[model samples]
Target: MKITKLQPTVVAVPYRSEEVWAFGRRRGQISVLLEVSTDEGLVGIAEAAAYPSVDIVLAVLDSIEPLVLGADPFEIERLIRRIDLVGTWHHVRATNPAIAAVEMACWDIVGKACGQPLVNLFGGRFRDEVECFYYVARADPDEVAAEGRRAAEHGFRTCYLKVGAGDPRTDLDRLAALRDGAGEHIGIRVDANEAWAPGTAVQLIKEMQRYGLELVEQPTSGRNLAELAYVRSRVDTPILANESSWTRYDQLSVIRAGAADVLSVDNQMDGGLLNLKRSAGLCEAAGLPVVKHSLGELGVALAAAVHVIASTPNFRYANQAYGANLADDVTLGYGGGIESYSDGCVAVPTEPGIGVQLDADRVERYAELYRAEGAAFAFHDDQPRGEQAPALPKR
Candidate 1:
């Protein structure tokens, strides 16, 4: 097989509204897409899950170019794991996604070449559709209620609300409104996004406990690990680790500390497929539930995540996936609803090679929007570097 260097392209898709978190908030997210090419006119593509910097996405892809440029397209795992000799943990986060980009691309190539679907490579399918959840954060208590009502009306039995980062009074008020709007039929899940402290979290969660909510994600602040564990001990509600659970060892830490009852792992942010696989295996071994977390990724990684979620039998909690209310066209022909539901459960997709394809023209249009949104151009003239300190002495 022939190898062609991959390149980074930026795309921006509009959110119907925005999903607020501990980090400021935004109405739209920038997407970075990497396209891999091989001989016999086949193509594979993957997208990084985070947008902290689109350049990081490109830098990652560029860094792995040398390792994958001349390799066979079918030796996916061997090449991905072999590159670990450079640095497993560090490079896994930095360069592995770019490598996953290539791996995903190669899967597409080989799947098409052999007329086999991607799940065949993964050993076969266990799921046909992935269940989904919808996020609701209007900041207005009434609006929050309205959003909850809409979710329920749309047949979404679960509501993922954004709390914490706002005023405490607002959080409580909105929680009340949300409960009322969803009534007793809907599952209520709150994501604090790590906006509160241990003590306040205990108090607030205790109040939220009265509602018999589903789970609280990162209720306490993320900075203090000890306090996180303490908050877990204090609350009766199940604690789902968001900010704190990033690795296999992290899964162990959460279990050992008795901090989290469930784990929400973002495959892209924690790293790509390699780390996600490792983390999933770890969670399975530990007998803990897993919730798929996505950073507003489009079809590629989103569909990849569906495959992973389906493959893992122990990931019983609802996965934080896209209802896919946003994509004009998806990798697969299917679209995720605003949230996943049937009897109020998400369904995993069964398609070949992640089951989604990017529209080149649409992606290009978003790339232009991303450039306009300023992924590479920044002008910040007034940020402190550090306090004045003595210079280092020459060796």
Candidate 2:
């Protein structure tokens, strides 16, 4: 059936705690939810992380409206190629989340039309459920320990914490606390977000290894694969590539450079769900495991990724999710808080399409929230702008 209309809604869902990273902090998740209505009366829904900014994502949707309005929902590949080549968005990685949302909606449409779940259509279920790590957003040593205990008590296999946002001593203390509270069984993954230099990364990782790191993510800058390789060679902790592997092309370069032990992939960062599968396959061929990265998504986007992750075998480790941080979700009951997860895993939905339906009331509530205070939810720092610019490879 032909596509009829695109309905876009911006929503801001509050987080249980602030998501602190190397660059800045956000108190909530801002997403642009898209509903693609078709001529056959089928409506496919998806959400795009308001990466970079909400205006950019909205602008991308507006620019792609003409390209998607009359197109066939089943022609995902051709449609995406048209959006990339014809729309001249092929070179613009920042515009990917919007394009990905549209593509995800199309896949939802395709699954509904075929009377099959997206997992089956993609490659069948290689797994029944996809495991996700509990995100520990706090930085205080006591808070980190408490979050770690909560993660372990919830039966989570992994706990992800953001590092490189402060001094090395502070990060070490937090890591030690997490290890103490989470115990020895639960794996601890730390993401630096490209904040450390090669020497600092090696030295810091060596010190942090005492706590038993499961993975050290993007210790050095992503722009230089050699730097990543150097740090990886020096540290016993396996390096997980984030910014270095945003796209399939970047992933290939990472593989060639032998920069990381594991590669992180994101559909929103790349283009679509199909490309997510392709990324897994590419990494699988290279004998590398893939972890699904997040740009801070809601249930709609989380569900879409779950279908692909379940259908793919290369997702060996627990993937990233905001469930531990999200206070509430717009969707009925899919993914919101730690309660949504059973043993740190979300089961694949058996219903046709993406399987999760948006709760109109909650959606409206969050939409209103976005309209009222969306700017505060964006990727921003508490520090005043221009006062102190964050330099890379912080020494």
Candidate 3:
């Protein structure tokens, strides 16, 4: 069937707490929900993280409408290639989320047409459910400890916290508190988001290891693989690559450099779900484990990634998700809040396509929220400290 129309809605879903990171903070998740309607009456659903900005994602959708309209939904690879080569988006990494949303919608359409779930089409279920970590927003030591206890109490296997946003002493205190509160069993993963320097990373990781780190993510800048390798060599804590492995090409370089023990992959960052699967395969061949990364997504996008992760092996670690932070979701009941998770795992949907349908009322509510106060939800911090640029490696 031919594609007919593209309906895009911007939504802002509030977070339970502010998401504090190395660069800035956000109070919620802003996503562009896309619905691709086919001429044959099939409608495929997808969501795009408003990465970089919402305007950029919206502009990308508008620009690719001509290339996507009238195209066959089943021809995902060809369609994506056309969008990349013909639309001249091959070099623009920022345009990926929008392109990925289109590809995800097409996969949804294909799954529906074939009367199969996306996991089956991708390679059947290598796993029945996908595990995700609880994201503990960066906060005071007490708050961090409380969140850690909450994650453990909820039966989560891992708790992810953002580090490198403040002084090394403060980060150390938070880690100690988290470990003390979460207990010895719950694995703690820390992401620095490329905020540290080689020396600082090594020193800090060595100190943090006292609390038993599960993984140290992008402790140093992603631009220099050598720096990552140096820090990795010095620290006993395994380094998980984030910005260094945004695309398959970057992943290969990271592999060649022997920079990391684990690689972080994101479909929105790379362009599509198929590419995400390819990323896993590539890392699997390299004898490296892959963790699905997120730019903050809603149920639609979260469910799409879950299908792929369920079908693929080598996703040995708990993947990233925003369930612990999202206060609500636009989808009926698939993937928002800790309540949606059962022991930190989300079961793959058996229904055809992505398997989760939007709740029109909730969608409208969030859509209006986006229209009214979307800017506040963006990846920016309103705090005065956020206005002053942080010097990298913050020694």
For residues 1-395, write the lDDT of model 2, one tens digit per residue.
99999999999999998988888888999999999999999999999998878898889899989999999999999999999989997766444799999999999999999899999998899999999999999579999999999999999999998899657888888899999999999999999999998998999999998888999999999999999999988888999999999999999999999999999999999999999999999999999999999999999999999999998988999999998899999998999988899999998999999999999999999999999998888877767878887889776
RMSD of each: 5.9, 1.0, 1.3
Span of 10 residues, lowest total lDDT, candidate 1 = 386-395
Superposition error at 324 for model 1 (Å): 5.4
Per-residue lDDT of candidate 1, residues 1-395 (tens digit): 87666766767766666555544456555566777787566777777644456666677666667877777878776676665565353544434345456666776677667776666555565666556665774467888888778777777767888776435777778888988887888888898777776888888899888877899988765445687889888888888897777555566677777678888776665545546766877877877888877666676766667666666666676677554335343334433345334644544444456656777677777777766865332222222556333221100
Q: Candidate 2, TM-score vs. the true structure?
A: 0.98
Provide the global lDDT of candidate 2 against the true structure. 0.92
Candidate 2: deviation at residue 359, Å? 0.2
| Clash pairs (backbone) in predicted model 2 | none
Predicted structure 2: clash tally: 0
Error of 1 at 217 (Å): 0.8
Q: 1-395 in candidate 3: lDDT tens per residue?
A: 99999999999999999999987899999999999999999999999999889998999899999999999999999999999989997766444699999999999999999999999999999999999999999999999999999999999999998998567888888889899889999999999988888888888898899888999999988899999999988889999999999999999999999999999999999989999999999999999999999999999999999999999989999999997899999888889888899999998999999999999999999999999999888887545865667677666
My TM-score estimates for the predictions, one after another, are 0.86, 0.98, 0.98
TM-score of structure candidate 1: 0.86
